[model samples]
Target chain A: MSPSLSWIDPGELKETLSRIGISVDGPPAPPPSFRPEPSEDQPSPPPTPNTEASPPPPHFEPVISVAERIDRFARWLEQLTHGAPMSIADPEGLLIEGRGLPEPLALASVALDRALRPIRGLLGTHQVGSVTLEIDGGRLVQTIWVVTPIGRVALGIMVERPLEPGRVELVREGLRRVFDW
Target chain B: MFGLTIASQKGGVGKTTVALNLSYAMARRGWRTLLVDTDPAGAIGLSLTKKLSQAPGLADHLYQHTPIAGLIVETKLKGLGILPTGKIPADESERFTNGLADGAVLKAIQTAAQGRYDVVVYDTPSGFVGATLGAMRASRYVVSPVQAEPIAARGVMRIFEVIGALRAKGHPVELLGILLTMLHTKTQSSLAVAEDLWKTLPGNLLFEATVPRDPAFLEASAAGVPVGLLRRRPPPIAMVFDQLAAELEARLAPDAKDVANEPIALVD
Candidate 1:
């Protein structure tokens, strides 16, 4: 006697495999003639033929990068400093982001960072919080450095009017928040 | 006395370094800590005091019946004491191993340290046999130091098996946690291994504090002292041990309130 063939549902097979921690691709889409009945309250939208030309759906949440965060912070600091020159650098004194800062001041910030980098050990050891330098035009180049999990980050601002100690602390706190230090 | 044995299956996984610095950190925290070297290689003695390397230590006490009290070496830290692996002669190495294989020598050491030290940290050699097994058999807790490398991470299971077997044998030894050491964040493989361990291991199985790969450890080893005492101001890496010690205290006594949480009077 010949045995009758039995077919296993692809969806059931996929679910069983997934339950056992084995991932397999879902079954191919059903044939066009097998469309499901739309619910009365929420009907499916009409299919659009030009799907490839349409823009992708917007994401409700967007992921932000550290470099982008630093850039945003630098721009905000620039507005606070009244368009004064400013820059932010990594632990290695490499510029991550900058705003309206002159070449001389940027070089000076990097130089200061390199000079003080050796003395600074780990995150909590002998931390050099901030440094201020007087330039030729009676302007103060104030630099605040913070050690983040990523590494040390410095924010330098050149302005004729120096920010108060509290304001400088606010800047430091802002940098810390940006890096989640 | 609280007994902690630093055990690992792989060599150079920072077991000795963790044991040495952890004991120092505990001593600094006002715990009368005694560091006992169970390794026949005399790593603890060589790392701390050169003079004590040749001196009679735990091995001598086990083999020749030397007094444990007399062999305890006082360190610069007032709260810390050292019992080095003294003079494991090549001829009597087998005897020493046999002595450690049995738990009587460890019981004697514990008895001697009962009232003297608040905590006794044992620095065992690599592998879960002989001296290491003896130390674990005598210890109330075991903390495994796993280097942040693929092979070292894989060896962690052997520690679990050893601890499990000891418990099955009715030993009161509990696995404290696996400490990831010598982690280089810049190295892709190192970071990957550390991340994998953190994600894969149970929340309570791994320590929150990690030891970074630093040259200061070598400097401290050369100077024959704990990394915390390497310079006038302790290196930043030294503070990692302080964090580890704090975590250990928290794990060992979860219900106990931290002294730091207590507020002090400004006038006083």
Candidate 2:
């Protein structure tokens, strides 16, 4: 059985924030609408118009194109992994973006992603978080499959050493941020 | 002014929701509050008023030296104000993030808000780098909303590590506590995660109030209003924020007397 949850009391929590220099004294009186109920004898004032206007609906065109996003993602990945060889491709083995990836290795990475797609489908899973492969040359190839607003794409990186767990988490977060997954 | 940042390492953890409602709650409690949106994507603007998309905001102020005072968008809520992310060009987004890394923009905001606001709440983008890091560095306190899931639980350690590093460097940023959000009471996995977190984390590190997973939040978001304003009478879930606010007030000012506790004469 999992342990039941318990948290700090209000006094202790207050002490924590106070020690950090947060002011305990409240601000001045709020707006009229936010004020407490009026006394029985006090006549209610006429209701004032709400000055806050409804903002226009978002009709702005997409500022960043798919190609630009891919390019930015590639650049961000390269910087994140310290210029490690990286490639991004569709499931059909089409190279959408890459940096320092030899043509053959890039193609191979996409092929690997392509091959895994059917396996994932057969297993009733639409996405694979990540896969790590050790090639013959002692290099590690890490691939993260992400489903973005555009489509499903595979991000692969080649590093001489195994990527640290924290780094991998960062990479995953970067993927989410850049790709809007 | 008190600087509080709502941050999380993982996405979809209800950071924006917490920031939005908590700031509004604080404002309703008579605290002049400024809600600053630090996400390059302008999430706060998008979530609330859509017209702010074209307004100059934090990014504009950071990059173009725009005055922070003029950038503030007043709301119908008297004590509540907002500093939207403004328009971030696609190509200049990286530059904007890089600009925030130095913490200058946040410092400027705090300086500008000093006399104007009683508290400043920052809603940061996901991940601990760039703008989030800048906000953390500039804030005196941070509250992380941890989604009730195993993956989100794993991400809590990263927040601690980052806060630890910040304090080690003498930045004086405090981790107020971890708030459990999006809890699904019916889901055993979610309950288990909450239980595990309560058991694993120190008592003072976790908040007592937990935000449940309610369809009302979705409804509120669709309507672009905080849960407190969802209906003529807000749904029951909206009261959780008031509870959370009371808890926060108690924590922020432990010695402050509670006027609500005072007795009222039967006839006067």
Which candidate number would show the highest TM-score if scored against the true structure?
2
For candidate 1, lDDT tens digit of each residue in A37-145?
4468896767756868988766665544443455456557756766555666666544444443443465577688778756775554646767889986577888888
Q: lDDT at A126 for candidate 2? A: 71
Residue-by-residue lDDT tens digits, candidate 1, B1-268: 7678998876556778999999999899877899998877677877776697778888778767888999999988897999988887533544665678756688678789887888889988666768889888888888998877654665455676677677768887887778989887777667766766665555566787888888898789879889999999998999999999988988785433235667878995
**TM-score result, candidate 2:** 0.63
The DockQ of each candidate is: 0.01, 0.04
Candidate 2 CAPRI grade: incorrect
Task: Give residue B247's lDDT in candidate 1 (0 to 100).
Answer: 89
- Candidate 1 docks with a DockQ of 0.01
Instruction: Give the lowest summed-lDDT range of ten residues in model 2 chain A.
Output: A27-36
Per-residue lDDT tens digits of candidate 2, residues B1-268?
A: 7688899876556788899999988889877899998877676776665687567899778778889999999989998999998887644656777688767788679899887898889988766778888899888888999887654665566676677778768787878878989887877667767776765565566778889888897788768888898889999998888887777776664333234667879999
lDDT by candidate, in order shown: 0.72, 0.72
Candidate 1's C-alpha runs over 4 A off are A1-181, B254-261, B266-268
lDDT of 2 at A83: 59
